[model samples]
Target: MKLLIQNLREYLRADFHPRLYLATAAWLGLLITLNYTFDLEDVYIDSLRGSWKRPVLYILLYTTVYYVAMGLWTYYHHRPDLWRNRRFWLHTGVGWVAYGFYAGFYGYNRWSEQLLDGQIYLFAYYCLSNLHSLVTLVLPLYLYYRFFDNGAEHFYGLKPKRDGLTVYALLLLIMVPLIAFASFQPHFLDFYPTYKDTTANEFLGVPEWVTALVYELCYGWDFVPTELLFRGFMVIGLSRITAVDKNQSGVILPMVVAYASIHFGKPLGETLSSVLGGYLLGVLALSTQSIWGGLLIHLSIAWLMDGAAFVQQWAQQPAGLTP
Candidate 1:
């Protein structure tokens, strides 16, 4: 832990810029307030759900989020280089496209038709939605990495070593209580243990725990693409290009604010935490040149929260009944 702290201190000392950081905070804060005030994701994004137009809207949305974050950097630092750099545009522009594909993907809405008379339609809906990140984010991003970035070493910090494994585990352990506390918030249980409403177990003649396990795994899988994009590509990949000032890689804050924007659909508390979480993970990724720690921390916290939701729901069930 001390080693991790030292590394973070070094990153902060070397990379911190007051103007860029403050401007990013003020800009992102306002957007976050407006989004939560009006429920913009559901109100505006979902306004075109299932239509061909939605992905275009999402591309525009994420592009705006990313560009403004970078724009703030350019504005505060007075550097036209990031604007002139084609690599920045290539990296972020493609990201907006991939995010749009994932955010607007409704092809899974039809997945039930391929199953047994759509008997497990809700099951298909929940499970497929969780797994769609593979096609939407992974497939495109991987292609870009191989062809565009020329196959970065350790494949964007996907090393097999046990480096910092203990710290990642400690991070996960610390979040357990926080996850438990948040599970009791209004509308929390209704939204989590995402398979709670799925009748896959009944259709398959198995216990609900079976379906829960399946959905939880898929729920956890969704974060792979997330870590890969934000920590691996955004922080690690973009760092090599020297953003912000001529000698700085302070795009971590920029990535955090943009990352937080994507969380606008969730509760305000959750959205707010994303900024802090993204910064910590981004620092580690930048320091170690590995996203493995971020992936471990991210997936563990997510599954832990989902697990807490499951336990809460189970305790509420009748003595002789099952979900």
Candidate 2:
């Protein structure tokens, strides 16, 4: 018990790192958890299709709000150098561009399908499929570049290292529970319900493989931007505001908290899992100075889980499943 306490203390005071990201994450997590638990209907998916204007506007609003808040915090609390890194701007710009591409491409495709075929399910499938793809493919690479390769040495004051075995082991350990919980807990809301619904239909006149392939193309593109904005941009940006030393545990805390909060609308178990998962990912990034490792593991687990769920649902359906 004494040793455990000491370790806990050490983890908290281990380094000069930012806590703002973690704090924001925690707040977001709490908000999501509360909304989920209470069945709050305030959260709405930006389901506007057709025009790029609405989607672009929404993205701009979210990014601007996030940057403004972060900028203010940095201005008041820390020196200008911390917030004025040129690499930060470049990374952010690239990330936004990625986000725009994803939203525009996926959104337009879905709208076109809906307009031409009047297939609401296709539109839904596109959204979910795209989300899953993006989370799996693009997010990790963006994270790798932004957090690990781009500014790791400068901010963390540490050299880059790579250990594939360690990363794989850590990823496996973290993902095991996420998989178990997702499988067993029916009460927990699946993040991509529309996609799940569409995929469950085995006989929609479209081959399953073809549907999956198309979904992957759009989804993969979108996944990159999401990772950049949430994990890459948010985590790295907040690091500037909090200014926690990278050598110690403080650096990991904020990232963990922020990561967790992003999954707020999930079940308690899922929410907690995300927090732990975020910590593990952060640790992986810190140790290896690479997001690729983390992203690969993340994408693998996500695809596996989604595929499993789709298969399970399809198997359970009666002979004629059409939706």
Q: On a 0 to 100 scale, what is the lDDT of residue 163 in model 1?
A: 65
Against the reference, the lDDT scores of all candidates come to 0.79, 0.50
For residues 1-323, could you state the per-residue lDDT of candidate 1 as single tens digits?
A: 77578767877776667987888888898889889888878898888868988888888877888788878777765666778888878887887799877888887877655653466888777788879888888899888888888646656677655666677777778778888899987667766755555667888999877887888888888888888888888888778775443236656877888899888877778888898888888887777778888898888888877778878877889999964
Model 1 residue runs over 4 Å out of place are 115-117, 243-247, 318-323
TM-score for each candidate, following the candidate numbering: 0.92, 0.58
Off by over 4 Å in 2: 1-26, 33-106, 114-164, 188-210, 213-271, 318-323
Residue 50's lDDT within candidate 2 is 49
In the range 1-323, model 2's lDDT, one tens digit per residue, is 24323434554455423665554554555555565766432243234444565446445633553454445345434545644676555654555445544443344355445653444455455655455435433554446555555444432212233445454556576666667557645653255322433542354576656666556555544544444444444454334434455433233553454445444445566667776667655555544444555555666666666655665566667988762
TM-score of model 1 vs. true structure: 0.92
